[model samples]
Target: MGQDAFMEPFSNLFCDLQCKIYFLLVGVCSALKLTVPPHTIHGIEGQPLHLTVNYNFNTTASEVQIIWLFERPQTNPKYLLGSVNQTVVPDLEYQHKFTLIPPNASLMINPLHISDEGNYIVKVNVRGNGTIAASQKIQVAVDVPVTKPIVHTEPSSGVVEYVGNMTLKCTVGKGTRVVYQWMKNGKRLHAGPNYTFSSNNATLLILPVVKEDIGNYSCLVSNPVSAMESEIIVPTIYYGPYGLRVKSDKGLKIGAVFTVDIGEAILFDCSADSNPPNTYSWIQRADNTTHVIKYGPHLEVLSDKVAQKTIDYMCRAFNNVTGKRDETHFTVIVTSVGLEKLAQKGKSLSSLAVITGISLLLILVMAFLFLWKRYQPYKVIQQKLQSRPETDYRKAQTFAGHESASDDFGIYEFVAIPDLAGGSRVSSQSVPGSDFISGQDMLSTVYEVIQHIPAQQQQDHQQ
Candidate 1:
């Protein structure tokens, strides 16, 4: 019974081994019937190249062997290198040109040349139960010519004249054995006298560019098999307003000196040739004070604000980039009214004295004329009376006297008169004298007689 048990365990072990061998045979047959395609490799001339080989093996093998072969057009294939398991064996001719890294089934070629362009085949063999073999091929191409190049400048546009340095660069797509050349207006430029090329021949530099240097520039790229030229590029430079001019703010002033009222304001604009606009300042020489009023192309000043009768004003223009400046000066004269006042003063005094004298003389003349006119009428009447001497005084008196007392009597008295023979002459009552009359006694008696005579004559005639 103990022997049977030991034999039973051995029998199970033997069956397991036989089954494992059967599966291995099936895997080897399957691997030998199929193959994995290889991948393509690409690289530029003078650059590193890497190639890969791909495959699969279904075998129960402890080790596998791989071989690499290289062939060019119109040439027979030759062994380049081989790798057994993890060990490598490279052909003597290609030992230094090619490298094989184990377990990856890949190859690397350093400093590849155009001549190295060809198809490479990798083969793999399995050494177990039944032998299996597979192979893959990859094609490689090399480029020895550079692609088109591009050129660029620092500043894009609006460059002023005569300024500073400028830099330009040239670059290529991809190439082997490449060379660069810089050209301006179809002429080749060299590194000398303010012109410089970069160490790698990829850049061109110009120091203190002037108006003469303005033109189209290009970068030329060349390789063994091809050459290319880049588009033109331009660099900008900024400069100056070398000569500046000054005038009134309106425009070119006709007169070099501007005349203005004392209490008015004036503006002066300064213009010049420059990349950026120039700065302006107004300077006035009055009371020995000098300072900046404002900054720009225009400067303003209030003339009346200045104390001096005659003042000098200057306009200055400056460019910060060019470190240059210019100036212009003008004079202003102020007038006074002193002379006009003096002339008017004499005329005013003379007019006042003439008016006063004429007024007094006119008053005296008017008084004398009024007095003579008043007395003239009375004198003329007296002359008329004296000329009429034929009129009797008594008859005139009777004609001018009152009527007889028999007419009517008021609360008054009357005297009777006789006939013309004068036997009993009636006496007439005398009118009483007014209070305004005052005279001597003799004059009073004459006045009484005069007053009674007219009445008495009338009464005598009536009788």
Candidate 2:
């Protein structure tokens, strides 16, 4: 309880200290204060300008005074105007230009000029219990509005690429404290190896102009009050004939070689990328000699009319203005591929006809073979067997004559058996020699030999 009592006095002291600090802040908030919304402002020449100020004070004032003063850099301040309650007073030198009202603390200047640009001070004073004074400062800038800019190029006739120089100058009719900038194709441009600018950026110079330097250019001029851009200007530059090439309407191209069908008429076009369009010439090389054949961009060649099967051709592009030239070479070959294609079509049809004819012949041969195999062989064998008996009987009769005794000299065996019922005697006896044989016996023996021949032997003999 004693400790708590001791701490209560310290708490009261802390609260009293907080109350004093709060009251001090309240006194500061109620003091006379002056404020200018913008610390700096820009104005155009020959225009009206206003310096606004706000002020408030808690003390009751019997009189209120507002005074305005102007000062330049490193110069003493000069009185411009003042107001007491509702009455206004201005300096005799600037009485008609400066205006003010009492308790307003604001000042106005009509017909602002470049010489009138400076710092302005507004002071507000209240007098009753004591004088409460507050002041604020404002910076003013005056500029002449920029007019439309004009750009002029040197040697407007034109320039040759890589052989000429160019210059561009920017000008404004009426402007003060102005700045200049250069634009190319609507984008800001900077210094480059080939491009330079004047100290004020009002002039641009191109050293040894090139093809890349050709573009739309403009100049932009501005001041604190106004800004303007000049009309777009394009500089003419003459360049060479580039990327020379040749193209044909009907041909098979491989690199620089063109293969055209025989008897075909092909049209070739020579072209190049150039500024002023190029003049073309066609040259043909044959038999170790070259000569210009045509003087235009197009040439028609008949494959059959060309003397040589393979030929060399050239397309020359010339730029008259720049005195530059470029050329490309190509080869043309006359071929029979189209005729061969037609022949191949005919051969394919002929081959199909031949194959069909051969197939029909093979079918006929197979049918003939089937007929021969089924009926012809049997008739032929029957005819041959029917004639076999007559042929063998005649052969046996001839052998019986023994025209050459040497042929019948070999040893022989003969057997005879009689038929019991027919009364024919069978002889199991050896025959006499050829010299002693009888005619009847010979005849019978021959008949017997013919009857004894094997059936297989007769078939073999017939075959």
Candidate 3:
């Protein structure tokens, strides 16, 4: 039983090893599929290049034959390099340039140049279990790197729109198999009525430079290996002072007439669509004549300063480069909400008020003086005399006459004269038949005035 047990383990070990070998064969068979990825390759000039292939076989091969061929359009395949088993055979012409490794089919080209660009064919034949064949073709391209290009314009000076011709040329520093394309304002440009191109599309000719041709232009240069673009340039073209008009900052503008308040200031701006900015001049027209009022793009008009309330004005815009000028005429109207008139009226009222105030003050002063003169001078004396006892009554006699009181109130005049020696003299004058009291009668009446009663009582006392 012990001997059988030892032999059983060894038998099982042998069975497992056979099974592993069976799976290994199956994996090797699956790997036999040949693969050649990226059948096309690009290479730079004066640079080394490579092309590769992959293949496998389940069992060891007695002989492996690899052959490489070169072909172009409408041409038979030409031999390049090959290997059989372990020996390498290369064409004498390209032996030093192209390298071929056996079993692993990969090619290397030293110092690739522009002339080595074409289709390449690689074939590998496996001799195990019958002759098995596999082949792949790869396309190769060689190119010199593109350099920065420059653009030159004919007639670099300013060209008038629709009158002059212009041409643009693109040149590269160094490149191989380069193609050129034109771009305007960041978009691809094509031939049109005014645009023509050279044979290689490297030069662009504009028969007539229009206003639309004034834009940014550039050239795009490209090759299989690299691409480059030229610097953007803007061509000069002179345009007109088009779409000219006038606008104001402050006013009621209808069509061309501007209405402004009497004392208001308004600013007028003149503008136009032009290549070069226009120089503006403001002109005032009066009595069928015109004169320049200001010289600038902006004009400030004060309504009060202008003599004519309603006037005609013009704004002229001239382009120095294009030699073109445009003029627009407008009427400026002054409307009366009567603010200025109201101000004048207010001034008159103020003057009249001042005069009336002065007159009133003078009249009041004169009235006060008249009242004081007529009564104030006698009141103090009368009061003092009345304060005394009746002892003065015999000296003062009272007269109760109605006609005496009526005759005392009247207008009196005073005159000033120069004396004979230039001394000043003042005299009082009263007409003889005037309704006024005489000096002596005034004294007597004043003495009796303190004892005044009613008029009827005075009349009765007289009777």
lDDT of each: 0.65, 0.77, 0.75
Better of 1 and 2 by TM-score: 2
Per-residue CA lDDT of candidate 2, range 79-125, in tens?
Answer: 77778887887778889999886667778889899999999877766
**Tens digits of per-residue lDDT for model 1, 261-376:** 55656677677765456777777766678776666777665767767766777778776766767877777654343332334334335777889989999999999899987776
Misplaced by over 4 Å in model 3 are 1-40, 55-60, 70-80, 89-96, 128-137, 338-463
What pairs collide in candidate 1?
241-273, 416-426, 417-426, 418-424, 418-425, 418-426
Q: What is the lDDT of residue 223 in candidate 3?
A: 85
How many Å off is the CA of 42 in candidate 2?
A: 1.0
Of the candidates shown, which would achieve the greatest TM-score relative to the real structure?
2
Q: How close is candidate 3 to the true structure, as a TM-score?
A: 0.60
Which pairs clash in the backbone of model 3? none
Order of the predicted models by lDDT, top scorer first: 2, 3, 1
Determine which window of 10 residues in candidate 1 has minimal summed lDDT.
406-415
- CA shift of 237, model 1, Å: 5.2
Cα lDDT for residue 244, model 2?
89
Q: Which stretches of candidate 2 lie over 4 Å from their true place?
A: 1-30, 73-76, 339-463
